[model samples]
Target: MTPYTPPTQDQLLAISVNAGIEELTQSEKFAHAESDLVEAIVEGVGQFAAGEFAPLNRIGDLEGAKLENGVVRLPDGFKEAYDAYVEQGWNAIASPEEFGGQGLPFTLSCNVLENLGAANMAFNLLPMLSVGAIEALEHHGSKDQQTKYLPDLVSGKWSGTMNLTEPAAGSDVGALRSTAVPIEEGEHAGKYKIAGQKIYITWGEHELAENIIHLVLARLPDAPKGSRGISLFLVPKYHVNDDGSLGNRNDLRCVSLEHKLGINASPTCVMSYGDNDECIGELVGQENRGLLAMFTMMNNARINVGNQGAHIAERATQQALYYAMDRVQSARAGAPDKTPVAIIEHPDVRRMILRMKALTEGVRALLYYCAGQVDRGTIGDGDAKNRAEILVPLVKAWGTDTGVEVTGIGIQIHGGMGFVEETGAAQHWRDSRIAPIYEGTNGIQAADLVTRKLGIEGGEAMIALFDEIARDAAEQPTLLALAKDCAHIVRWMRDEASLDDRLAGSVPFCTMAAVAVAGWQLLKQDKAVSAGAAPALAESKPVSVRFFLDHIVPEAHGLKASAIAGADLLYTLPSDKLVAG
Candidate 1:
């Protein structure tokens, strides 16, 4: 199993100072205490993650989650670990202080999530989902809904889940068949009786918390077709009393959990709401405005999922690096000793390690940068907000796709043992596989990048982002030409190509943008390090940036060409005939 290393104090400090996080927190009266508080929080989270959560990663994977008698029992130690997590107040690190949370900057929370996710992703999913639920309620929930739900949710006395996917409606949310009927009278007036099945619900039915709050997306009886007519509901597993005590059971149950290839410990549940037509839910926002509200949570989840990619990649990189150092293989080139040397000495293995290092560090920087941008957005910075929106899909898609790639490489580093499940390299690869598929598939993300985000504010966001990257690259002699190459591809996609052409190469284009953004961030770090700040961590900045420029950046031009190639060849071969033997 891989050892989880918390972000170096130097790295975290650099990110905070560069991202204006200090300024943001200073505005909140944490100016004097910012350095000390950030350090304490980071150290506290790292210790909790390594001591409590890391040990259980393997056990959770082995035992997975068990469902019996309509209840979900987490793998042994999971509940205890979750209790430790709650006790440490890790759940409320970035939540608003008014709601019993610490109200720390999102960037700091992201660092905590990275450490925890690397330690044990399956266990971490519980709190990750809860954060999204808190965002939805904090932004869009009714006053009563917030008062009744926010406290326990914020306090970690309760857990939460987002119910969006159905068997028939995974990515195409508009096709969901879940329905809700309005309640006419009594204490529950304006509420709805929700009835439908929701599939792939993460932490949907766990026994670790006093209550489980489900944020469900359902259509009203007289609602129109598709997503526009949909509404959001806050449905608790156990109904609550006027005084906040738990009451009768709601009409919902986890029918089953999926046996997955990776992250088996995080239950992917098949939930049936209102089998007896007794499931009641309060609207989260105005009727017919549910998608708007759900997006508040979904967008947060996208970045978080991107961080998952970074986390898994970081874990995989650590394992691979360790394996390379310990794994003895063929002799090094020109070495007099015939005895085998560590695989780390092998040129190709070193290359692979560097690739993993570059990707992990690059994505980590990008994710943290996005987190900082989010904090800026929260404080009402319009440009920062738009940039954050533009970067979400990139971070989610590229970050995750990179995780899958890096983990596979980690497996490769193990040689024979990597193929065996016992070594744990394979587990990382398996766990990372789902990231690109969920939280909006990478393909959907690409399409969004091409069609939705590229056109935001009449393309001002895209323009500003390109300029931002290019400007930074211009200052760094090593990255100037590469940045120009990236700008050329982006411009080609925007000015010359049709939507179909854009989608054809969306994946590559997205990758190009992510690498460029990451490269820019790394150079920024390099500059900081050049000033003798975090000198040790800074030394690697140039190497990672060089590797990214030489290896990863070259793919952009080709991807742009492929994107402009159009869809003619793709459709020319009939799908049925093409697949025939």
Candidate 2:
């Protein structure tokens, strides 16, 4: 098997350049940083990921996490690995300095996330979720809440979990039955007793941190119906005392751990809160406004999910490439020799490898670029903020879908051996599967893109994005025609298509947009190559871009056609008839 290697300096630089990081660094808001600083950080993170985290990937898959009694015990070495991660100060690399963070750009942080995620996804999720919690608290938490929680959460001493799912609620968060009732009298009069059960909670219970901080979504006594009645709360596993010491345990416990198809090392818990009516939780932002604050955390998580997609794809690609080169098979089509040759020499194997390579690099380019927009948005760039908002769904949906496709291809490249668990190829597929379902299902993401994002600011963001795509195609021959097709689709959604039609096409539109953005990023790479700056291992960039243009670009056009076709055909059949065998 081929050994996993960290991304090189040139690859990092090329990605950064394509992501517009250098341009952002020159702006007044980001002028404090330099390209060299980011490069160094990427190199450092790569080393840490390759050494401390990569070795744990298979170990985590094999050992997995176990639930014994009521406690969730991590697989062996997980605790030590997590400790090493925290001790290295990686948890605060992108957090604000006021909260004891390094205050670095999220673009750089995303690079770190990609490396760590590729190394060991289950382990990487711990700190990744914490970072999202920190963002939520920093943006919406009260001053007192910030002082008490930000430091520990930012420093990774306390891990965090987002509790938005329930067996009854799932994606329809408004259907949640969790309740938070205010205590009118007591030492904690301002707090509320939270009573509810949440399932599919990732890292809901873990031993890696001093405490597990849960950002829960529940309804108050006087709250309205549906989502409008929901509120956000901070419920810690172990209560904090007046002096910052640990208090009695909260009334919450992990009732059970889910047995899953992948990411077995990460504990997915079914948590019961306030079983004894003692689960006290403090309001995060305002009463009945929990969804607003929780959206912050969820939005952050969506981007990371995209990164996870890219990460898993990269890992699968490495494994597949290695196997293809090393696994000797039948002789080549035109070879004179009768001796068997490596599978990599075969045309079909080469096509599969190219497909994997193109999708992996393309998605990585899209995700990093999305992160860069987030950085600009953080700096108060309204246009960039709008761009980021619209791109979030596409990144999350397309990236994960690509991950699944690429990983499946990886399995196929390995032939029957890939189906066996021992080769580790199948695990990538299992791990990648969850990303599409994470944050929100890809179907939901597509719906959001068509409904909420396109109509924002009078469609100004969508308009600007499409305009940029058109302009981008002028220099890249592959995109020139697709860009024109994208423009017509945008118009169709805006004027020709009804709301139902838009919804029907939303998934395709989002997929189309993702491919377009990826093509744009790859075009930047093509330009970089043309300019005489290239990586030592970048011989594949040109070919990968070409493969994407030839094989993937037409799929975008087909999706556009489907989107334009509307939902009429989908509803033609009666519901009962559709279900008939």
Candidate 3:
């Protein structure tokens, strides 16, 4: 049996209640994606993901992506699955209509990727990055660039890679030493010769797509130092003729692949550009503005990365629940009929399952809310965009952390069998461990939340959201208290905190804010039960929300002391001394 089962009902309810799907469809931009159409899309993608991607999950992890003859090869069946993914138009659902997309709501696309990630996290990376590329180009690329690239990229006939990290530059985009020199003369006079070594290039090399697009960041000769000097370039694996036909191979190739903790089925390549001094690339935008353009892509990726939390957590929770219900173990603690019983009846096991359910559901609701904000923001709701920007770090950081926790809980429910790979239980945990570390680590997210986002519109928007949540959670005073506390801390952070203090307390404050925000969404779902907002899930939704408010949201209160703790204590123990202990 496959480890994943798409939570179709839960997803739809989250979209309905959390994403405000009805309100979203009222916007003229997304008017075509009516309730019936949205339902059909979600169901179709769910079935497709289950049939095409789920069975391949274990196979992909077992066989993994391979590098042979300097070419990266994905697991068998990947090409066929990818073909189905493209042929079905799943890749272009939310892309712009001008570029061959259906022009649906962002939430619809989010649902599609969520299903794919749940089915096979590794397999979805290919299309996820491609969508990110489409976003970047749609915003910043020149008309020629968009015309030449958007259709294929949106169609999933071509793939994309963001080449940012090098050995010397992981998160510090400015520290990169890659160079791009102007050609000055030729058929491609405006283009430049790029030379660089990029590591951690996801899907950098693969045969599934007709072409691979590399968005490379490099420094122009004699440009200003640091990040201001860097520029973004569109470097393709194969040159495209003016007629849009594939031409000769470019001077880039995958030199090596990394052996990673998980997602082994998705190739992480060490890409070398201009090895033969012939790699040519067109500038993506104005010179030295690469970081700004790339941020467009990064911001989108961050949200999806956060949603991966919900994706993996849902699959893991389902697997754990199934195993607990069927795996016969010790007798119930108090029941008189005390022969061996299913572990589902055990208190401890019950606790784990409930916690997993609560965390996943809360995180899912929050991300879905964020998705709705995107649609609202796109349709001229500037306030909604501001709200989304503030919540993104929370989703990216806290959501991913929840993925790791819930997946680990899933493994715990499986017990000894969980530790063994044969049960496919541990793989969820293993695959989930990377979420918090990538797409701008959870630590970076915290720092951004406290230092940058806390100051948005002088923190008024954030405080207002807190005020709303607090009002809604009046009966659940625990959540109300946490919401009020988070709003107060936002004021302190914006007005009085030192940079060091903000950095030191960032993580805890991040956790505190995320929990409060999540409580806000969970409570919304809970209130919707009898209101007919999410009728399909009325029974289970209330239970999950109650569990979250009572058990999980309390963590916010516990983190307050740490959240406000100043920087002094963190520096008291020197780095070496701290490590020595």
Candidate 4:
């Protein structure tokens, strides 16, 4: 496995030009995140990631996380690496000023996540989950709650997890049967006894932090049914007294840790709360509104999950590029001496490598762009907020899908060696495979795009985005056509398509829309390169953007018909007919 090296030039250009980092820095809220300061932060984080995290990735993958005697243990060096992460305050980069954070733009924080994810994806999960919890608390938790928890969470001295999934309720949060009953009178009055079993909790258990803060979704005894009944609670592993000292252990325990396909070093726990009728927690917000608050966390996480896709793809691309240049293979087509040359010289190999490069860069641009919009949204830009909401699903779904595709291509570039564990090409794929599945599966993201996003401002946000793309691609005919097609699809999904019909085509529509967005973002970089804005990437940027627009953007054309195809055919066959005998 090659040590991860940060693609500083490309990353800087993506965040600066495509994401408009300077524009973000100009905002009063993010004035401190000046371009030079952001650059230095990115550089320092890259070095730290390359040095501390990259070296342990293989070991983390091989050893995975362990659970023994009710204790969850991370891979060797993993604890020290996490301690370093907390000690350096990387986790607090985007947290609020009142919460002991630097209060920098989320754009820079996402860059931090990208670097760490590229270096070691599994190791990144510990903090990634914390990021989500921080958002949830910052937005929904009470002042007392924030005063007690936010400091440690922001400082990374403590960790956090989102416990939403139950064994029976994965995508559907409302189906779970967790219950929280109010305490009428006691020292813990106003709090509730939370009792439920939640599964698939990422980083649910770990010793890296001093405490684990769990954001749980449960229902009040008198709560309404389904999603409307859900309530968010802040449940700590150990009770925290008003004076900030730890008390006895709470009633939650990790009954078991899941055996996963990837990110094995991050424990996915099946947590049982109040097994002995002692798990106590307080409401995060108004009752019956937990879903809304949790979405605050999930939405933030969805974008970062997309970020995971981008960086994991970056990692795979780096390894494959290195391997292609180093591995000796058959001679070139016109080699006179017939000496074995590197496989990178092969035409087919070049094709695959370029695809990986183009897609990785393009997706990364979208990731940063999407995150920058989120920061813009935070600063009271309603239009930007709506746009960020629209872009989240696209970035999450397409970015992860791209990650999967690029990693697979990386394997192909490595030939048989890629399949072997020693080459470490397969680990990237194994790790990325989960990104699209978790964080509201890509299918769900697509469904959100079609069902919800297109309905925003009667589809104005979607239309305006496509219009911007179409306008930018005026000189580029292929990209312009795709952008126009996307606009048309938005209108169709909004005006003509029925709910069932829109859903039937939602996944493909998401792919098409994402391709167009990524294409335009790449075009931004291409134009920047041509205009001398990114002198460092003059030669490579155009090549990558050209490939993406020419080869990748056309993929949207193929998805157009499928995207709007109605649901009739999908329901033509009954459930029994499609079932296995």
Whichever of 1 and 3 has more lDDT, that candidate is: 3
Q: Give the TM-score of candidate 3.
A: 0.99
Q: Write the per-residue lDDT of candidate 1 for residues 1-581, one digit (tens) a residue.
A: 86677666544744564465667765643343377777787788888898899998888888899898988887778788888888888898888788898877788778778889999988788888999999999999978888888988998889999999999997889999999999999877978899999999999998999999999999998888898899999999999998999999999999999989999889899999999999999888899899999999999999999999988998899899988999888898998988899999999999999999888888887888888888888878899898889889989999999999999999998999999989899999999999999889999998898888888886667867777777767655445655565566557778887777778878877887787788778777767667776656766777876787777666644465665577677788888879859
lDDT over C-alpha atoms for residue 372 of model 2: 84
lDDT of each: 0.84, 0.86, 0.90, 0.91
True lDDT of residue 356, candidate 3: 97
Better of 1 and 2 by lDDT: 2
Instruction: Give residue 167's error in model 2 in angstroms.
Output: 1.2
Global CA lDDT of candidate 2, please?
A: 0.86
Report the Cα lDDT for candidate 4: 0.91
TM-score of each: 0.96, 0.97, 0.99, 0.98
Which consecutive 10 residues in model 2 have the weakest lDDT in total? 1-10
Name every residue pair that clashes in candidate 3.
none
lDDT of 1: 0.84
lDDT of 4 by residue, 1-581 (tens): 99899998898998888778899877799888887888898998999999999998999899989999889988778878888888888998999998899999888889899999999999898889899899999999889989999999999988999999998888889998999999999889889999999999998888888899999999999888999999999999989988988999999999999999888888999999999998999899999999999999999899989998899999999999999999999989987889999999999999999999999998998988888888888899999999999999999999999999999999889999999999999999999999999989998999999978888998988999999999999999989999999899888888898999999999998998888888888888888878887688898888988998889988777888998889999889898999978
